[model samples]
Target chain A: MNAGQKSARRIAASNGPIPRDTVCFSCLHRLTHPSRRPASTAAALAESPPIPSHQQRHTNPPVTTAKAPRKAYQLLASPVLSRPPLLTRDLTSFEKAYYLYQKRLNERLALPFTRYFYYKKGTPGDAEWKRKIKVRKTPARDIGVYAAYGDEGWNDEVLVGDRTAERESVVEALVRDAEGKAIIDEEVVGDENKDGLAVAGDSKTGEGQRRDLTKVEVERPVGRVTEADTANDMRSLSRKMDRTLYLLVKNREGRWRFPQDRVYGRENLHQAAERILVQGFGIDMNTWIVGNHPIGHHQMNYTSGGAPAPRLAKITPNRLVSTSRDRAEYEQEEYGEKVFFMKGRMMTGQADIGKNEYGDSEFRWLVKEEVEEAVTGGYWKSVKDMLAER
Target chain B: MALLQEVTSTFLRRFKAPPASLHRKWASHCRHASTGAVAQETDELEQSSFLQGEGPAQQAIERFDPAGVAKRRNRRLPPSRYQFRSPRYYRGPLHPHQPPRPSEPSSREFAPGPFSLPRLEQTYHDTLASDYMVLAYAHLPPGQTAFKKGERLRRWEGDSPYFKNRPLRGPRGGDTLRLLRKPVTFRNVPQLQRVTVHTMSSDAINSGAALHVSGMVLQAITNVRAEAHEVKKSVAGFGVRAGMYLSLTCELKGEDMYHFLSKLVDVVMPKMKDWPGVKGSSGDFSGNIALGLKAEEVALFPEMEVNYDMCVRYYLSPTFRIWLLANS
Candidate 1:
């Protein structure tokens, strides 16, 4: 055999196989020489595949079974097994309030839970879903505003305004010590902790900040609501939704529109809008976005009061037992009530059909095409305008 | 003096209540008085001796027969008496075809006769009595009539498709009733094809330690050392690039597989919270059932669980894919 053939055979014998490719020559040379290789490699190369002597050295020492503790398998099977210990303690009132407040705040500020998605049933631009938003006026107390602040206007404590300057101010006030000096830094007061409870915002502020009700001499302009006062910020749906708007429909009656509610005395328009949403369509204000401002408004001539009424009436008018059946309970009065259409983004709650003014109103989330087909007359024109803007 | 005394007594009776002795006599008269019925019955029995002698002179004794005694030992319970109220027998027919047969009085014309004998061929208005077959049919109730069976038997007289190529066996050696056919042989092979642990992380591309630790975790959990694989293509947006060790995978077979599976099913899986047992539908149609565990859950293995706190954050939960090969 030639010298090259002999070396190839020798290399194969030492290191299994050597590929006749680039850069393998050096590895072959290293395998042939024991002195050039590392001690670990040399030791590994000393043993063959099936039963490696080097692996034997690495094996764990034989365990002395004589006095070893009984294994899990060897233990006597008992009827009752120990349970995992409880990891929590009953919450104190302060902790409970803190968590509850945090939950509400999170729910209010968190992104809408549901995404706007619909199947393209027909051609694009065909109205699918239609809904009407009802607007009226009611008393502030009915909308959960208990104690009114003396024309500061409404007490931030009593008012369920989506946002107020006093909300941050109250938190700023609580961060101060008994001497009324700022204990925490200004930044900390503004910053929400991991729990998002606004560590500075205390439950005491909701009660302690209540001021006595007093009439103000100065004329306070009403209906001045901004985006901050309500969570009207348009949130993009998570999925790639088709360019379609779904109108909320009341029942199977093709009369599709956003459910509307009345504005109560002492209640801001946004609060009234949410109240209407809750009562009319069973949409919880917490889980949905009721715009601070009305998207559209229409005037209807009916026996109604334009200005906020002293007391709020039920959304569903109750027929008085004393009144005659022939006489309409809700007869037109002297004045026309201006109805505002507030746009709302549905988040996480289901509409309670049982709570609807009209018995058994089935709310359908219909697409743009279906909405156009379902709604007609003045409603159709208004909806068309709304869709045009989109 | 007598007139004065009578007037005084009369005046006293008129003015005051009656005397106590008179009231006692009146109370005794109002009370129910008992009659001496016992004495009268004894006197009557003594007078009428014939009336007492009407019944048997002595009590009847139970007779013991030898045959009856022997038969009692071998007495087998009647099948009907054992479950006499069985629903199978007592329950009315679900959908009876005909109304119940009405009873008819026996007549002379319908009496039994030798109608089957050809010598006694006689035409009569009572067809059932004249013909034996008709009589037999009449004897049976409507429900028990074998008209359908007789028709089915007669149908085989012509050239039958079932007996076209084969000779028909007589009533003796016909088709015998037997149990169902043999059970089907299943070709499903449950051998472990391969065991792989896959991990994906943006951090691994930058820090080699992440890849090493992942491989270590996979090896520690499975007891089979894993090989680290790198992403061949660069995806800049996700920070994934070529030659970046993105995953660690291991394959197990034979004993290693058995040990891993036992630990997974017996120990690891049961410890998981909110785990509704794996549904039968949770597979890719193939035999392989892909099971995923959270990082904290995968740390339940002895090796990882021991030093869990130390490398808790570093441990990325890799999906342990167990492929089960089946013989097609």
Candidate 2:
């Protein structure tokens, strides 16, 4: 071959079709070498590091027969961390409270736990969501506060006014230092912590700092509330809600409404509970979801699949309890001066009626008894705690 | 109103919680009173089955077979017997909160989306506690170091969306590179299509949320080598995007990404605030959300495991995403 074309090829004696003496197309031998060139280009490849082709270095490690610790070796030995050795020393109530308080404070700064909780009643407004990065609130609950419960001025339960941290700590301290006999203020009504003995209340503080209770203000669950408490309890309902209803069930009080069409297809809780009051709530407790619609004032909606069928019909006013917290207001809002008639229509394809979650037939009060029975025998607030056993 | 409704709904879920008191009472009584296992041993010596027995304790165990056994495995449980005496007449968070129709929550039917939630702080975390989801909505500044999973952040009662602790697979490889054991999937993909027809009062609503997915990293470099014995570089920041391989299936009529996303703020929350995942360190959760959908909705769409690999990148991660699910 001519010198010009000769540079493109190579010959390998051991490797057949290729000659032993040849340089790569880009080699200096190809560009500027003696025409005859060296017999082999073996020196070139030997000195260079070969780049790996397509295979990835480590998509996964080689599956080794030798095992890893698997879990913490100690964890493998015991699985669970042994509880902190229970103290050998008996702790007084105050000591226990102090321990719990210190533990909680340490926990407060500990990580992440702080990011949760608080601001539970409503979703932050658009501007608020943008401006308030700390935490958020629930929309439905907030709407209720605005539309109906506005400024009853709660200082205790919610974090609306501030001094909340001090309040929390002070409460913690009280739990640490206060004696069981400390009579609670009437203001210290609800048990802040589940322990039935402890009551957390807000003392009026215009300056916004936690203040100690006036000694004999502790509230306790008396020997046992009347059959009302029992009645309320047996049904998974509570009487605390009466106060809220006392405030909302009115033409003047605000309303919490649901989308009108949503009344169907979804569950109506009030009627279901009424069914249970007449029948009885079964094992699988029924629950309800609430939301707001602009239709009107605070309105209640109930839904549940786990409800029992109603046993009675044509409930009358005489059969109803008038002094109920809920009844007095619901009657006024529902009937008004003009008087709205009891309306009824099927919930489309809903099957077996009488109070299952998807069951149809929302009540249109035909008589005063039905309305009153609904209010007095209706579901109570305490019922929300079926899980509070500990 | 929507926010309050959601919290109320969440609060309401506790209404359905298993009667801890009842469970505890029944468990303690049944467990203590049960000499049955011992009695059964005695009966075997006499005549199996033919002897037949009677006792309230034995009967109680029989009455609460599955449940009692379940509580037994994890002791110190809530009462499993009798629910609150009678809730037939209860209403509102016991009264006024009720509405004509309870909202059909997507959360009720589906499990909360799993996550690599980190509890950077120890005080807020316990190795064994389980809680229902806690959802907290916050308006963060344009920049405030995206909160890490395990970092301590202040919160209020009933404020967080973190629900419970779910053991998950951690990351593998070295500390620098990690991976979840299984492809962490999102069952709640927001369906934007149908969201519009829900007839939006749509008002001017701005919302943000914090959802906590509790799981351990499938394979993680818990202890990495810095030198020989090695000093671990304190975990700085971590983040997981919505998908390392997120796939979408919102082709159906009304459900699309946006529609579902809108609803996400109110539902699907964390059980606790800023909880850390197995790593026990909150990784900054921030990311571009990629919607995940069920395969039945469309054959053409891919799955979350393979599609959403990008979700867990190291250090710099996007913010927490709100996943709205149509059929989660």
Candidate 3:
């Protein structure tokens, strides 16, 4: 037996005449030792120097000790008064409150987050047919910010005008003279022709004027080829490995896609996907989810500079961008990059085309058949599993 | 003259009163007529004491045998020679599980290959079309009949006189009636299609750690990271803003949805203290189901269970919205 139990036995044996109080060892220890007495007689103990341990006895009936020790002894002697082995206690009010608050927060966050998988929906219109035909002499590559365009009210004429402007820019870039002056004065002539087309297209729709204005000032880079354009083409060379479903954007490249951005070094696939949707498509992150899990992961090989490399885009704390001239030194080279495709649905609003800073002409929420028709080969095969009919 | 007048009055009074006692006696006699046969049979049976403790009179009770006195042979016809037989039992020389005989390679083309693929032309199904899109329960009208299945509902209105005149020769032909006769089973009954998870911060609006923890917790539960859901409008009461990262959310559908439900109901819910399950009254009366979960209760999920000690301090109760098709 430990010291406390030994002391208990000694006390019990010495006080044989009276019924021994089979009190708890800790309580008995307190009684036998004068220094560790409870504060019930603290005042009396303080007034006089504490009774020495050797002189202390259970029979010594001091006035201050009499009432307190008897009560304590009675409580200790009770069979039901045994202490638990672990000596744990129930949570305090403050801790309980904190737990409750935390619980409430989890419940609020655990509200089932919904993600929607939308395909490019609608019958191919005349303008859409024209956009599908490659206007640029160069192939349309997978680079640049392409995202789901949700707004449907925008007119096709504006999109057409935007396209023509983009074509003109490309033509100008391709046909530049040695002095960098345009050999073609076709822009002015093209403008006049487009204006005529706009008037005719406008007579068919009410929003003709807005369409005309947006064609000139649309933020999405239409025909301009960036580093991403070349990189995307190189990366997407092998159709066997990489699979991607493209969104059909009217007046822009027909192949817009579910928004995806480059993953920052620290961020994971889902975080990057959410970031892409929010920044590129103007989706409300809190209201929607990319998906409960990634539908698929696609890897593509590419060559940057001269060596075979994976495409890497510069990631700012808030947004992802293609490498710029100023930040070239700091640009981190990422190779063999993997893209995770997830299903996303809007909880509050339809596709917010207004927030789509990248210029996509119009959005069509496609069905499974339409999605299959819009995308080809490996991408369609992967996407077919995740298709949501509703 | 007085005697003659009194006699005439008495005669008039007698004609007017017309046999009151006689009418009552006739009514009592009719009542007895209605019950006479049944009452006689019961009275006879009771007097005989047939149903009382066994006596000599109890043997008078008769019994009927539904199948007659003797049992008849119960048998079925033997199988026909043309009936299909299982290959395992009769067709194969060896057991069905036994491998095919190994042979030396004749040619690489003739040899069994490890992989197989369909031809390009044969890659797709021809029946897939947009026209087949049928919305299930897009809306629900109230009432008992509205929610019940197997009812013959007028899904379409054939106003044409031609259709009305030739019901058997309509678009569906004779099968139309048969199709209508098929009772709507539970499979055909509309169920929840997907569940949406909406996560919001219960802590300070701008606490980075709280948002991070919320996102991580959601990720662990779903096996996919939670996407940030920005507050669309600023609320003074909650100190939220239009573009602030308010919470994270994700949608679970098909396998993910059912799997999560199984975990929530089977694994997590039983561990919670004093937790009553989703109330029947909690339904919107259409078809959608919504339930709230406390953070502590959510922690019981296998995903979050292991992390209790290093628990994310901030918590937010989340609502799970199960979307189902409403009765159209």
Question: Which candidate has the highest lDDT of all?
Answer: 3
Best by DockQ: 2
What stretches of model 3 exceed 4 Å from their correct place?
Answer: A1-390, B1-187, B313-328
- Chain B structural similarity as TM-score, candidate 2: 0.13
User: B106-168 in candidate 1: lDDT tens per residue?
Assistant: 221221111111111111111112122211222232333222211112223566677665644
Model 1 lDDT per residue over A47-133, tens place: 735434553443222223233222111101000001111111223333333433433332333333221121123422112111000
Rank candidates, DockQ, best first.
2, 3, 1
Local accuracy of candidate 3 as per-residue lDDT tens digits, B24-75: 8788655432121232323434345554645434334233322222234265
Task: Tell me the deviation in Å of residue A31 in model 3.
Answer: 96
TM-score of predicted chain B versus true chain B for each candidate: 0.40, 0.13, 0.41
By TM-score, the best candidate is: 3
**lDDT score for residue A124 of model 2:** 32
DockQ for each model: 0.00, 0.01, 0.01
TM-score of chain B of 3: 0.41
lDDT of each: 0.41, 0.25, 0.42
